[model samples]
Target: MKLRDELNNREGYQEIIEFYTSSINEYEQEIELLLEYEKKGIQKYSNPNLEIIKSTKEELRNAYYKILKSMYSKGDTIEGILAIYLKLISYFTETWKKSNGYVQMLEMLSIGIMLKIGDKDFKLLIEAVKKDDPQDLLIDTLISYRDENWKQLSGKLMWNKPYKALQEVIFLAKEDKNLSLERLHKYLKKEWFRGAVEIQTHKSKFNIHSGYWSFESGALVKILELDDATLKDQQYYPYDMVHYKE
Candidate 1:
């Protein structure tokens, strides 16, 4: 069960890891709920707390569809609507910095859709993300909207699950703050989270700051910086290149 012992064997490494990491209570509870539903028995979007998240996902999908509708209001065209979705995905990714959870969810959603809906829709999104500027639209109205939402989500409760291997941000997301940051940070530092972290940056920097939405002040928000500097730190990313803005 020691880390070295497990990784030493190549035959059943994955199976061993899954067995040790999986929890009993959570797994059983989720499985029971699925059986009760008498459905496909897939355990997703089933977390009790995720009900609101599911609703939020619906809202975003509706927003994307509406954008498509407006663009094609004059006359419905398949290509035009596809163009709108491609732009929407880029805009969505450019803004909406909430819990790192959003990024994982969006990637999963994009992948799932591409598999189900076919490669045609997938191509549009791929084009948008690959090409920085929209060849189709001169103006990006979503730019402002993405910024506004980013500001709002910044203030909400968030998680700080970083990648130890990559040393980059991973599952940064929000859930009700049942535990204090200190408690959560301690929990993360424990050996269990080391594996949870895929990688850390060359900077070897890791920290979490607690901030909230400041509607009235409209100023910079500050919070406790809970990270330590390490010699192994990676390079810092410039704002313009990362922010998806000119």
Candidate 2:
């Protein structure tokens, strides 16, 4: 089948195409205004020490949301919404890579896309991002989403099977003061699909002590290093464990 025919055969695909085609001028206008604000920020804050003003950041965010809502209201699927968001991010980031507020704008826009897409659509969203983004935006966005979800989980880990065994380790740490990296590796190998490699790599990528995952809530929690000499210190010395709310 032809590509156009293939796309048209998908439910809601033609509507999404029509929506973007009709709204191209509007999208361009918003993007142009947003880029103007970004350029102004770059000129205003020549010194690397200085940050973009809050108002300028808010303007960029508003422009992004305006376009986002437009596409969302057109009744596209979550995958379609993600495609729209990625295109916008790609366009804006390429246009203003050095703009003081560019990364901040992308961060805000990406998170909003995830939340709007919701946890139930995470797999579809990630796949769309992986397919479209070449600059590792999906990796950054997923880490951010997972971190936010962790905070919402409080000390309780997600109850899904992938995390269930890890939760047992968390429970043990709560009961016994701390958990060593070795012990975490053991449970991760047993339970997590990607096992220890996935989390250890994430630890470095996110600049955290160790581990990152998300849950139903919208906040992120970080695992921190803990050591109590009285309890007994392993070779790793301090253990990595879930941070308590207190």
Candidate 3:
């Protein structure tokens, strides 16, 4: 495993991992406290306070996802990365059930699919994604992998962004595998990092600069079963994750 050169500060990355770990623990403890209060029939921490509990759990899962990305940036083993990913999924599923198909981030849906989660979990992801109404063809195409009858979603994405590259790659995948690979290579080189300036520049306390990964690209590769020989070295392609095996 090699550390992403973009994340040059190994010490800073470790610090981020530690910070999120601590934040996750705090959020967990806060949830436990909230539950205890609810169980005791406290007026303020009544059923209505479930929203607070839900929010805390959301924060906890966000921290877990951050750790997963940071650990990958730190060059952790695939097994280790998968372990944290599974934990995050478990948390996500619990919250989704409670919130009636809530999805915290659209990107997470693609990541979960590419990770090769079980069919039942994938179904939950599909439902949550549909509920979120992503309105993007790329996400709809992704869902079409599981539900072949899934209709094409309607909307236009801002063409100037990096996602346009991904959208082109997805369209090309249906026509020419070679062309798709070429487009994906171009995406990794030019468009990927340019789209995420905040993380690249480390502008905020919340941004905990993790490794840059194009999970959508990884998902498309897995779905299309494309030869990623040319993409293995691409900066944001997440090649190992696309090829990860249990």
Q: Which candidate number would show the highest TM-score if scored against the true structure? A: 3
Q: How high is the lDDT of residue 57 in model 1?
A: 44
Query: For each candidate, what is the lDDT?
Result: 0.30, 0.37, 0.71
Specify the poorest-scoring 10-residue window by lDDT in model 2.
Answer: 211-220
RMSD per model, one decimal: 18.9, 18.7, 3.7
Question: What ranges in model 1 sit over 4 Å off?
Answer: 1-13, 20-26, 30-98, 117-246
Instruction: State TM-scores per candidate.
Output: 0.19, 0.24, 0.83
Q: How badly does each model clash, as a count of residue pairs?
A: 24, 5, 0
Order the candidates by TM-score, highest first — what do you get? 3, 2, 1
Which runs in model 2 stand beyond 4 Å of their true positions? 1-23, 26-65, 72-76, 97-246
Where is the poorest 10-residue window by lDDT in model 1? 213-222
Candidate 3, residues 32-72: lDDT per residue as tens digits? 88788788876464456578888888787778887887887
Clashes in predicted model 3: 0
Which candidate gets the maximum lDDT versus the true structure? 3
lDDT per residue, candidate 2, 1-246, as tens digits? 122112123334344345445556564555556567676754434533123333433344344433443344333344554555554553443333222433233333344433454443444433333344423322333344434642222333223344444445444555553454344544433444343123453224322222122211111112223243332222211111111122
